[model samples]
Target: MALTTKGNLGPGRTEQSAFDAVHSAKRKDLWFAAGGLFVLAIAMSLLFTLIGDLIIRGTQYIDYDFMTSYPSRLPERAGILSAWVGSLLVMLVTAFLAVPVGIAAGLYLEEYARKGWFSDFIEINVSNLAGVPSIIYGLLALGMFVYGMGLGQTILVAGMTLALLILPIVIVSTREAVRSIPQIVKEGAYGIGADQWQVMWNYIIPAARPGIMTGAIVGLSRAIGETAPLITIGALTFIAFLPSPPVTGEFPFISFAWLHDGFTVLPIQMFNWVSRPQPEFHIAAAATGVVLIALTFSLNGIAIWIRYRLRKQHRN
Candidate 1:
């Protein structure tokens, strides 16, 4: 009986210790969760505060005239027509240049490239490039596109610069999206004697489309707001004129001359306004900032809607 009592006490003590450890772990998890919420609240508060301030300062300045007229020396007459139009044209170029190339490169790396040191090296470099400073890309564009290629400080050069800046982002996103597709999906395609291209085209791409679009949205969002690369490549800050109209009334009915025209984007325009000492100019800058933010949100909203549609279709 004495020996049995000692054994029972030993098991009870072990159970008690286990219970204590679990309780302590739960306490730690609760503390960590609370800490995370506190941090998130602080971050959200700051973002809302900044956005609120911008809206309050710029609300009075935003109107139809502000959207239609050009930037002027007088703050009351100043507008963002040229700036917003330039931003639109530049983004058009960026999306055209980046999307296909990034998606193709990602497909090659993930599906076709041989597993080797060279491929690994390429992967590492691609990942690293996503984190590279925007200014470096600007400098690169200054040297390569502006000087070497003689594209001049035009919309084309700015587009190419931003394309390069966001290429890694799109590629990474594509690859990740592709990876997220179930392996069995590809296997099923292969087991049915479908070739690589067919499997990729009919199966993988459709399933991965939503993620790829999301990545493009993120990359373009970053590209649209980038000032360093565009400024470094000599984007104008105070342009008062729009790029030549992209469409022509002539026989071709399309024109490419606008691609070569000098441009000013919203960020640079806002920078120009904000640098002035006048209070009115500052208000104009706030308005410009508001427009820029609205444009970005609009783009994101469109992309998100498209992505949602794609996901719904895929699920169906």
Candidate 2:
């Protein structure tokens, strides 16, 4: 059916048109992808611009006096001092509580625990726990530590609560990282007469370093930003004195009282300033926000760098 003089409905025409249609569609798809990227870039630029504005407008208020000044009884005079110290103290406590417990739990589940219904149930519950509102965990801490256990609402209790709040995230991340290791590494260690613990610490885990570090950073970052649970557990909104960074009894850092004491965090303090009637307080809040954001970025950066180094080490 080569076209008669009219060239109507020729097989060659059909083939040529179909090829042209497909080619045109592919070109359109490429353009669509490029357009999507352009939009995404614009959105990201807007976000950066907003952040820059916050820093510029806010940093005008940030100074050495701001860093060292304690919270004032008056909203107008208050600085982020107490909140900064409390956040530092409480976060250290949360880190101490969360890292070991989470890593251990992850290890037990991934490396040692037998595959069974109990394990499945625990896994399901942990996932569920991660999704639980952080405020609920704070309430749990309030009930158990402050009221039930008779510990005052202090930094220690608040830290413990936040620890539990973020524990599931840490555990899940750790487990995934550990699970990513090649089974062959474990087997190789076993063939060399190594014990389970030995293989885990020496071979399998090291092989999965990047995943584990990434997960740890993710979890830790989440813990750092938590406000709800710490609020519930009674992290102090303002402390008159800075707690020492470590426990030596000479300068007390640990919150011994849990029941009546209050605690504070960067976010909570930020909230306080932001809510105040004074524009000056809002300026202080923005400054504190910059510090908080910087802390989070620094931690993430360190973890990522560590992961990269470990990966390179393994490759070499």
Best by lDDT: 1
Per-residue lDDT of model 1, residues 1-316, tens digit only = 3456443234355687887787799999999999999999999999999988998999889999999999999888999999999999999999999999999999899999998999999999999999999999999999999999999999999999999999999999999999999999899999999999999999999999999999998899999999988999999888888888878999788899999999999999999888999999999989988888988898799789989999999999
Local distance difference test, each candidate: 0.93, 0.79
Weakest lDDT window of 10 consecutive positions for candidate 2: 252-261
lDDT (10s digit) by residue, model 2, range 1-316 = 6647874444565687887787799999999999999999999999999789779877877778777878885755667777777777777777888878888898899889999999999999999999999899888888888899988877778778878887898899888888877778777789999999898888877887787667767777777788877777666666666654344455455644432346577888887778888887888888888888888899899888999899999988
> Which candidate has the top score in TM-score?
1
The residue pairs found clashing in candidate 1 are: none
For candidate 2, the lDDT comes to: 0.79
TM-score of each: 0.94, 0.84
Clash count per candidate? 0, 12
